[model samples]
Target chain A: MSDQVVSPRPGAQVQLEMAEQPEVLARIVGRRTELHELVRSRLPSRLRGISLIARGSSDNVAVHARYLLELATGLPVSLIAPSIITRYHHTPDSRDHLVVALSQSGKTPEIVDVARRLADGGGMVVAVTNDDDSPLAAAATVTLAVGTGRELAVPATKTVTGQLALVTLLAEAVGSSIAEYTGGESAWAALPDAAAQTLADERLLAEAVAVLQPRGTAIHLARGLTYCAALEGALKSKETSRRVHEGFSSADFLHGPLTVASDEVAVVAYGARGPVLADVAETARAAAELGSPVIGVGAPEVWNGVPGAIGLAVPQTLGEALAVIPLVIRGQQLAIATTLALGLDPDRPAGLNKVTATH
Target chain B: MSDQVVSPRPGAQVQLEMAEQPEVLARIVGRRTELHELVRSRLPSRLRGISLIARGSSDNVAVHARYLLELATGLPVSLIAPSIITRYHHTPDSRDHLVVALSQSGKTPEIVDVARRLADGGGMVVAVTNDDDSPLAAAATVTLAVGTGRELAVPATKTVTGQLALVTLLAEAVGSSIAEYTGGESAWAALPDAAAQTLADERLLAEAVAVLQPRGTAIHLARGLTYCAALEGALKSKETSRRVHEGFSSADFLHGPLTVASDEVAVVAYGARGPVLADVAETARAAAELGSPVIGVGAPEVWNGVPGAIGLAVPQTLGEALAVIPLVIRGQQLAIATTLALGLDPDRPAGLNKVTATH
Candidate 1:
């Protein structure tokens, strides 16, 4: 049994897909000019608001969208609770609102259901999905394809990045320039190479992996835009490594979940520059003081000075949202690496269907 | 040191507070008529929407509000991203929105900040907090005090129920009659005794506890209103037992997170009679088949027939939202009981403050 090598060995598809994120993102960036115009053309001239409906990793991406869209466009953005449609048979009036539904399969029953209802409610329905031929695309007023050909691994690496890229374009369409929004204009175009750099950084990734005790639980923390990275990171860890990794808004942690921190647990936090970074540093310091092993992912200055913290500085970038692209890859790599260390296959996470069906 | 018992031993405050929920809820229910009049007077003649700003356990309670208010009033409800105010200094137009901010202490800087910003945006701000003299109440146009007095335990059981009760009363203020909202007309009047009945059911709770292996992680599942119970349950387990427990929308879990379940994990699911109940039952069946222990909390018929599943039927009720109150108490008890089983103090979770001050 020990000598037999399983087909599609541990971490195979996930590693391949993670490596492909650079090319996939570059493709999205190269098409940004066309994508931006497409989004602008579909959007209502005077959008009263924006509401996003999504599930799983796509939902984490929507969290980033909520922050960016509201800040840039000065419009209130919401994450629609799909059960209100699927279970309660209710659809709050979305007239004149840009209701965006995101799904990798474009066939998740709830996501598709939400897209249809938003359209029925006079919303400007925009479907952001990987499948252009799926029912979600057919139901939407406009479809923004992710363009990632196929995602074999159930954990969803490239598709998540693809969704983030499309939402980034959506932000640009809504009158937010990358430079003004994040203070890093070149950051969008540089994402591919940045992700590649993160994927290739074996030194930090190895050190971070070594710091993880094989079977310990993990707590992820972040604030503001980078917080979505913390969530996606935790999801990846949970899906692939089958570890108990939950993410919290860093500020939310100080509220209650901080009690779970201890030497027996690993705390992974994401930070960027500014006051949010200060909170992250304090969180790391506090977690370390409680004897929890702290792995910090952010700019050097954010985590470097925190005593007893291990730091993995994602490539420096200005837009906090754009910076998350590279940071998320770091998390994906860690999850895959951790899965391999545990002798599990990242591609075939136990009992996971490629496309889960639930009403 | 070994012979001396610590004062206010760990878990004591949490247990005492849990026991106080019935009295506290009864007090709130007794005031519903007068409280309803006060809320009606404070609200605008025509509200465009509702936005709730909260953090931690209070935020989970807000999830319940989102479902109830939207289902009843046909108005859009959103859980505000507090960082948008505290960090970004961005206030999206909330002109006719009834913005409600909740906090146990009414002193969480972020919640207070959100209330002030909502007030600045021409929104009628309401504060649901335990402290009427606190800054959040001062910043708001109106305050609905939870009246839990001083909640010394870090886990926040009584105040959470107190806050839930106030939100329930607020729903009645906004066009939802207690009888029509929850199918059972007596649900509201019966809440106090229902909670008391749950607290006295030592047999079911003991069975539930025995099903929870001391060091194993637990996954909580539910749909619609009961999902909030799943979240609070997970939070209590995290705060008190120091165990890895996370809540997920039942449908969302199928998309991902289910991969983490195994023989070493326990699944605690909340269910009631509805279409959503079928999804919960299937989830329990699936998790049990994956070799995880399944403890179902709902009506007997929803879970009793599932092979290898243990059912703890909560007292039956009509409104899905109303049913959550008793279920949450069960979760709180499991958290404290599990803490005892693990030989840990629930009253003082490591490194947690009663009021977390984070920016």
Candidate 2:
């Protein structure tokens, strides 16, 4: 069962698109030299820091990138509030900053507007998207096309992984001491296989969904880089399954959100074997004690001997951050399986468009 | 009904602390010069930017500060992920950065660890806390006491507003051109009256609770500064009422969280008569059409003509960010009212402590 490759039933655009993550990640790895060269040419010569503007799934990718970039480069990275530009007509001091805008469609009005303002404020703007000719691209000093092709799914699975891959490559290229901190080059190179291993384990994900499908409300928890996975997972679940799914950092759950912990709410905790694993384990154990069913996704050590939790293994990786690549695939699969379980279309969630044009 | 300053039952420490907000805000405003001078002394001489680290209610205050500092000072602000220090054993370059840690007890382990590391990394550390001699204050270069006097409430109210006021003062002191944007001086002077006005209008909040108390799940929506209100509101509601209350930026709500909107989930939108008002209004209207009961908190113009929403007026302020001082009080009041309606103690929520010490 561990070595078997199971494919989800075809014709669901979201499932098909999500399945492309491994191949797309491999292509990004293979073309790293070219991508790096392109990035070097477009980046501001005197860039001191990086700021990102994004929303929804793209924003989750940006969050993952924030941890990746700062850990690798030791430079400050900020997620800019785009309303300061689009709503307030105010632009911060952007000089010597590399402002990156991420969107699948590149047509989100506020993001495009933010990119234009950043570029106008003398910051170098880079657009990462599937569309090469998107308005976001035109508004930026440089465009790094995600190369996921046109995504038909409203939830954005493939383009998200593609954007994450591109950011990893960018961190590897620009970071002065990435190898000293993270084996950035090798980890990016290893992403393809990790993603493949994750996608190959469709049975584990289906089993997880079988445990989770009956719950009407769920809380997804993770720490650091994987925290973004929990957020993206909750977003996918809420939109696709039409259920109440909230995501919080595992540490934060103990603070106050734990009051919502009860038998009625299921808990999903993403555990990487790291310093924070203890905190995550404690949270899961506490939630289980409170009678909530818990799903533990990571190494067996994280969930071993814990009462009332179903455990799934995380793909092997160099560091906890790199493990996010495979961890999120499980999230994507869980969303898809849950949608199917609810007899809903994962590709077209009700009242959702591929491009959320907000200003 | 409009002018009566009704108080919650005396025994509940949370209600008593919540009632302290108006007076605490006035004290912070009146002592602006001394607070500003203390901040100036502790702030790094060549501070390039600001970074904040906190968790739980303190983290929410930090979010509000991020908005305040960035808008008032035009400086890049980043919320440091505490796990990067506590779990990953990594600290990004902190030289030329001003790191601020907010806590009511000044004893949260992760936050204290983050402050110690930042100070060790050559960054200036400032502790904004209610306890002046707690470990967090001892680890910092300077401590600005919130002066709320040992809050017995598990959910922060007075200390939260005190932290926000201190950040506003810090921003005013450091900002080069704050007068060109927000009338920072006048607004600080006006906060006391605005807060008193807000607290005096208890009937409006009670009416809001009456409409919202029946719902089992809810979404709180706001944009920009008010978005922090929504988040704090959700936290207070989750801890006190034990109901599922999620918060989102109005624009981001339009992106995905809106899918959870239904007749069963009440929607609360914080609207101000400002540039982003239209977007917030649109979201309320959209949620209402989806059959969710909408509670609009702000100017009458925002929800007066909109269908399926009850309007509660916000106290007038010089700018939207300053408006948050009064806006969030309504949220705290609503949480208290909802908790009382549920026959729960607002002070001692089950399974929660005053200070959550996490690794």
Candidate 3:
């Protein structure tokens, strides 16, 4: 398995490693102030609606942004997919809508097209991207470069978190106190330390991988913004480990998916702050008792009343950080572990490609 | 395969057959008018804010109701899953909310509890159901009985359509002229005949089934009120054929799932009355051209421009009816075909029971 690992070009390898680091994350966080300043200055203008557009992990970031902005400003906000907007091209009247496009690689053709359409339709455009000179940035009315340096992994890590932070700042600028509502400032500050702490807890992570490695299927569960995170997490787990995973709202899991719980299945529940969290946790624990391995990810103190439990007390800040980095590591570990279990190469699966393009 | 067909009990078989006939459907439609009258008389009082509670297919019906009501009255409405509300039982002040629960059997424990919770909490309760004497009917402040006689198929068909029509009527009664918006009394009256005509198109039905049967995965796509119908279709497909299917809005599909489209897969696009339908049809057609077969279900003239299309045109009313029934038949056919492909009995799948219950 180790012999099969053909390392990428030296520069790309370094970028990938940097993308996995806590310090790199902190640097991305520092740029939020500038982005917020720009967004605040434009909020009072006669914008009819706001649209956040992205793809894959960036799409999840847009969802978080939409939720935050809607809660903060009570403004009409819609999460737009670049493919949906461009390929379908439902032009909102230029007089009212603002389009915000998030893309780690500002060159993704879909993102560029969506931005161009909004600009062409005379809607205000804001591009949040990791690359400053990319086409998406060039096409936008205002470009908020997410200074995340470079990202190399196919599954976005640091860039997505950076994007979320940047979007939150934008939401705040637009009079959404969601950051305050969600203890955002503290959560942002705690992220770096949280990343460091979670990584330091290698023993717990190793245990988690051990429990999850044998399972062929998993259910990823959470609510609200965390639900979006769970979906990305599930996708990461699938793409990296070649496992079948489905994401569901925490409460929704109990309605039907719970019936299929088995000893070989694992249920990963993200405990978000809500009145229903306790009930969701209890249900997760019950599933564990019923044979499915259950992993609870949330603040430690939050599980006080959760019954029949196997708790993995993830810090709130760490929960967000781990949403990206830990999943990648775990996925990588599972790949290696499963390969060894089946006597195969960890780095290569038959008929697989690192980058897939369908003609 | 013929010999493998296990006959259901006479009474259940009769009920099931009755549930599929035009007369039973018409009876349900008549009940919808009565429901509309009841709701209209009580409305202006229930107009401020509405919250709907439902589960499974019934939940989908509530979404349709929410959409039509919002369109008609411009009222604030929310569709709440029973599990979510039940989990958040601590929220005592729900008086301003009007809760409508839709279930065919009125026996699902979750639905029963939701009705009791909303009614017991002083929220207005309305049950749109077939079983007039069922517990859910008794628990509700108002019961709108479809009187569809009985439904024997494990996968619900006509009852769901009944629920949808009833909910639409209820929405109309609550201050929105949904009937008028949908083209007045004439259109509503023509629906049953349209539905029958659609069913009689056996060749189109078979073609749709053939396209859908071979796929390992499918995605049912729709938007707005029809989005809920898409969900029900996906759920039915999954439960009956044990296939992996997901539902998403026409606009939402481009976010990530489009990456998986291949000729071997199938996607069923539900066309609704709106500009979005053209975009959805075009996207589906593109997907079909890329190899995934796309089955378009809608009014004939609505998606005339869809590319790479194998179009199945049904009248608007017929489209709704065709959507629910053909899937049930397709499920049965797929199960039989797959069973033969795998050299198994058409009547049974390994490790599955006629009734599934888990503690």
Output the number of the lDDT-best candidate.
1
For model 2, the stretches where C-alpha displacement exceeds 4 angstroms are A1-11, A42-46, A177-190, A204-207, B1-11, B177-187, B204-207
Better of 2 and 3 by lDDT: 2
* Span of ten consecutive residues with least summed lDDT in model 3 chain B: B350-359
Which of the two candidates, 2 or 3, achieves a greater TM-score against the reference? Answer: 2
Interface RMSD of each: 1.3, 1.3, 7.1
lDDT of 2 by residue, A135-170 (tens): 998998878787867777667888887887777667
Candidate 2's C-alpha lDDT?
Answer: 0.78
**1 or 3, greater by TM-score:** 1
Q: How far out, in Å, is residue B280 in model 3?
A: 3.4
> Could you say which candidate leads in DockQ?
1
Query: What is the lDDT, from 0 to 100, of the residue B232 in candidate 3?
Result: 69
lDDT (Cα, tens digit) per residue for candidate 1, span B189-275: 788888888888877677778878454688988888788889999999988887778888888787778887787888998987765
> Per-residue alpha-carbon lDDT of model 3 for A67-97, expressed as tens digits?
5565555443555433334432334444446
Please identify which of the two predictions, 1 or 2, would achieve the higher lDDT against the true structure. Answer: 1
